[model samples]
Target: MEMLSGAEMVVRALQDEGVEYIFGYPGGAVLHIYDALFQQDTVNHILVRHEQAATHAADGYARSTGKPGVVLVTSGPGATNAITGIATAFMDSIPMVVLSGQVRSDWIGDDAFQETDMVGLSRPIVKHSFMVRDPRQIPEMIKKAFYIANTGRPGPVLVDIPKDHTAPHNTFPYEYPKKVKMRSYAPVTRGHSGQIRKAVDELLKAKRPVLYAGGGVVQGEASQALTALARKLNFPVTNTLMGLGAYPGSDEQFLGMLGMHGTYEANMAMHNADVILVAGARLDDRVTNDARKFCPGAKIIHIDIDPASISKNVAAHIPIVGPVKQVLEEMLTMLDEQGEVGTDTKSLERWWQEIAGWRKVHGLRYETNEQGPMKPQQVVQALYKATKGEAYVTSDVGQHQMFAAQHYLYDRPRQWINSGGLGTMGFGLPAAMGVQFAHPDAVVACVTGEGSIQMNIQELSTCLQYGLPIKIININNQALGMVRQWQDMQYGGRHSQSYMESLPDFVKLAESYGHVGMLVEKLEDLDGAMEEAFALKDRLVFMDIYVDPTEHVYPMHIADGSMRDMWLSKTERT
Candidate 1:
C-alpha cells in the first residue's frame, strides 16, 4: 500500500482523533490541505466567510463539545486572520488545533509568495506550535498538538506544514506521532500531601475563609470536588468569570462571579477573607483590582495545572501545581481520613443566611417602564426567564456582553461563550451558530450590541444556509455602547460621533436572509418574543431590542480598577 503525504497524514491523524468537523477558508499555500480533505471522508469542513470567523467557530465547537476544534487555513493572511481567534481561545483556555500551509522548504525566508512565519507569529497565542519540515513528522506533530491542546490547561495549538512536505513520493510512511516530547509539559498530579495538609490547617485556623475558584475548576471538571472541599471546610466559593459554573448557582456556598464586573458581595468576600484557597484560575488584572490591596489579610494558597500561572499575576503563599480535579479529590480524601470531611449543617446554615443577606442587598434585579424602550438588563433577564436558564449564551463585546455576564445565571461552564480575552466585536453571532450546530438539542442565544452586530452581520447568510436555529437579540442602542459610556463618564459628554446616525432595520435584514425578524419595543413583549423564537424550527430569528442608552452595567470595575472599586449604581458613592 502506498503511503500518504504529510497533508493526508494530518487528516488521517485528525480522523483517528475523532475530529468530525473542521472550520476553514482555503488559500494558495494551504491548497494541499484542502485537496487532501477532498480525498478523505471522515471530517466535514465548514468554509467560513473569513479565517477569523473560522477559528472562532472552531472555538465555539470545542467549547460546546469539549473536544478539540480543528481549523485549516492558508499561509500568510490566512494565518494572520486567525490570530484574534487564537488569542481569544488562549485567554479563555479552549482546546483548538489550527493548521496552516507554509511556503515550500526551498523558499524559506526569501520573501516567497504569500509566505509568513506562522509558528513564530502564533507562539504567544498557542500552547504549542509546530512546523513540519518532513512529511513523516506530520502525524507525530498532530498527535502532539491535540494532546497539548486537550490535556491539563486547555489551549490552542498550531501546526504549520511546508508545501513540499505534502507531496507524495516521500520516504517516510504515514505513522502519526504517539506522544508529545516536552520535559516541561508534565502536569502535576494530586501528590502534594504536605501542601494539602497546610491548606486544611489554614482553613481550620482562619475565621473568615473563602474558596477562590477560577476557570481551571471548569477545565478540570472539578465542580463536584470543589463543592465537596468547600462544604467540608465551610467556606464560601466565589468564582471568577472563567469559573462561573464551578458550583451550581443554587448551592448555598456558591458566591456569584468575581472580577471587574463581579457581584459586590463576591468582591467584598474576597476583601474580607482571612484565608483564600485559590483553585484552577488565573487571578487576572480584572479580578485582583488592586493586587497589593486584594485580600489584604488573607493567606492565599494557589492550585493550578500550569506552574507559570501560579506566580505570574497574583502572589500565592502556598502554590500547589497539579490538575485541579486531582488536587481537590486528594484534599477531600485527606479530609475524610482526618475525620474533617463532614459538613457542619449549622454553620453552613448560618453561612447561607449571610449569603442570603448579601443577595437581598446586592443580587441583580431591576425595574423598567413597560411602555418605553427596553432596558438591556430587562431584555437579558427576560431571556433568562423565557429559556428557564437552559440555553447556551454567547455575547459580542461591549456593554451588552457585560450585561449578560451580570444578569445571566449560566448553568454550565462552557455554556457562556464570549470573546473574553480579545473582547472581539462580532463574536456572538458566529460563535452562537457554531454552538447551536454542535449542540442541536439546546437553543442558543447571541446577545450583541448594535455596533458589534454589524461587524459580522454577513454571517446571517451562513446561519440561514446551514438551517441553524440561533436567536440573535440585538441590543440596538445605535452607538458603540462602551465608547459612548466612556465618553459620557470620562470625556466631556460631547458624544464625538460615538453614536451612529443611521442603523439598518435588523428585522428587514433578517427577512432578507429568509429568516424571521421580530421588533421588540416594550419590556412586556420580551418574553413573548423569546418564546416565539424558541418555537421556530431550523430558522434564524433576529430580535431587535430598542434599549436605553443611559442603562450601564452597574457595579462596574472601570478599566484598570480593582474588583473592589466598583460602582454599585449611577448615584452610589464609589
Candidate 2:
C-alpha cells in the first residue's frame, strides 16, 4: 500500500483509469487538486476560460473517442456553470466524470465562501452524484463515478469533493480499485432471444421497411453491425441528427437524416414504413412531432439498452432491451443463419423504388450565387469538399447545425459531433478544442453561428495556449438565425428581438486572440479563404462568412402535422 493525500489519490485513480486529458478551470476551492495535477505528467489538464467550456470540451472528447471524459472545477459557480454542459451530456448520453471541489464538511450548512450544493444542483442532470464523506473513500468514489458514467446508457456522473476531504493532513494508504460493482445497477447486455426472434420474423414480413438509427448506434460502436444488417435486408437506413455517419451518406441505402430538420425522403419513409427498426433512438418530439401520428402503420422493433427509453416516447411493438452493439450483432447472426430467407425481395425492391421517388423532392437543394452573399449550406458543402470529408466536424445548435447535418455527408461514426438532445448553442467551439486534442494530427472544424460562437468565444485563448489548430467556421447571419426562422414562420413575420443590433468585429477579435482571421462576404472569396486557412497548419483560423440574413432552413414540416406533411421550400412556408 502507498501512503498518499486525497488529492494524490484523485490523480492516481484517473491515471489508473487510462485518462490522458482533462478539461478544467482552476479556482480557490480546487487549488489542492490543481497542485496535485501540477506534480503529475500523465494526465494533461486543459485550462478553459469558463467552467462551462470545460464540460463541453470534455463532452466532445468523450463523443469523439468513445472514452469517458474527465472534468475538474472549483465549488459553487464552477459547479453551476458546468450544469448546462452536464445537462447537454445527459440529454445526449455522453460518458463523462465531473469532479468538483466543495466547501468543507463542517462549513457546508454555514454557507461559507465559494460554497454551493453541487450534488443538489446537479442531481436532475447527472446519471449519479456523490459527495465524498471520507478522505479514504476517494479512490473508490472515483472508480464508481467512471463506472456509472461509462456503463449502461453512458452519461455524466458527478463527484463532489469537499476541500477538507483533500486536505494535506488527511493522508491514507491508497490503491485504485480494479473493478466496481453495484448490486442496484446492472444493465442488460444481451437481447431477449424471444424478442430478437420476433423482430427477425417481423423484418422478413415487412413490405415497407426502414432502419432508423440514432446516437445509440454511434455510442454503442455498432455502425458496422447496423450497416451489415441493413444491407442484408436491403432496407432503407435513416439516421437522426445525432446519428449521422452510422451508415455511409453516399450509400444508396442511406435515406439521409430523419427528423424535424431531416431529409424529405427520410421522413416520408418513416411515415409510410411498415416495419420500423429503431436502434438507440428516443422518439423525441423532433423526430416524432406527435406520437399519435408517428409511423402510424409500422410494427416497430426497438433495440435499446435503456428499457425506459423504449416505450417512453413511442410504443414499441417488439422491444429488444440490450446493448445496441450486442443486440444488432445477435440480430445479424440470426439473419445469417437464415441465409437468403431473410427479406421479402419483391417488397424490399418496391420499398426502394418508393424511397427513390421521395428522394426526388430534393429538400437539401440550396442556391449558390457566384458574386452575391453566400448561402450557409454552400459553406458546409464547401467545407466537406475542402476537408475531403475527413475532418472531425462539431456544431452549435441552429440553422447552421441543420445545414451541416443536411450537407456534410459523413461516411463514418463519431465524425459529426453536436449538441443534439439539449440543443446547447455554445457547444461547438469548445467541443472542437476537445476533438483537436484527441486527434492532434487530424483536421477538426467547428461549424457555428454568430450567436452560438459568442457564447464560448473566450475559449479562443485556450486554443492559442494549447496550439489547437481547429478551423472555426462562423456563419455570420448577424442575428439569432433559428429564432428569426421561427418568428418568420410562426409569428406572422415579426423579427422582434431576433436580429443582432450590436455585433463585435469577429475578424479583429480572432486576430486579437493570436489567430488568423478571414472574412468572406462573397462566394468567390469563400474557397480561397478556406484554402489559406487550412494551409496554416500550425495556427487556428477563424472564417467569418457573411450569408443572406433572410434565408431559412427548408423542407420545413407543417406545425402539428405528421412527417408526411412538409414544405419543400420557402414557396410553401404558408
lDDT of 1 by residue, 60-170 (tens): 888777888889998899999888889989988989999998989999799899899999999988989998877877888888889889997899999998888886545
Worst 10 residues of 1 by lDDT: 340-349
Query: After aligning candidate 2 to the native by TM-score, how far in Å is the CA of 560 from where it should be?
Result: 1.1
Q: Which stretches of candidate 1 lie over 4 Å from their true place?
A: 168-172, 340-354, 558-563
The top-ranked prediction according to lDDT is: 2
Error of 2 at 49 (Å): 0.5
Give the per-residue lDDT digits (tens) of candidate 2, residues 276-310. Answer: 99999988888887788888899999999999999
* Pairs in clash, predicted candidate 1: 139-177, 140-177, 216-280, 289-562, 289-563
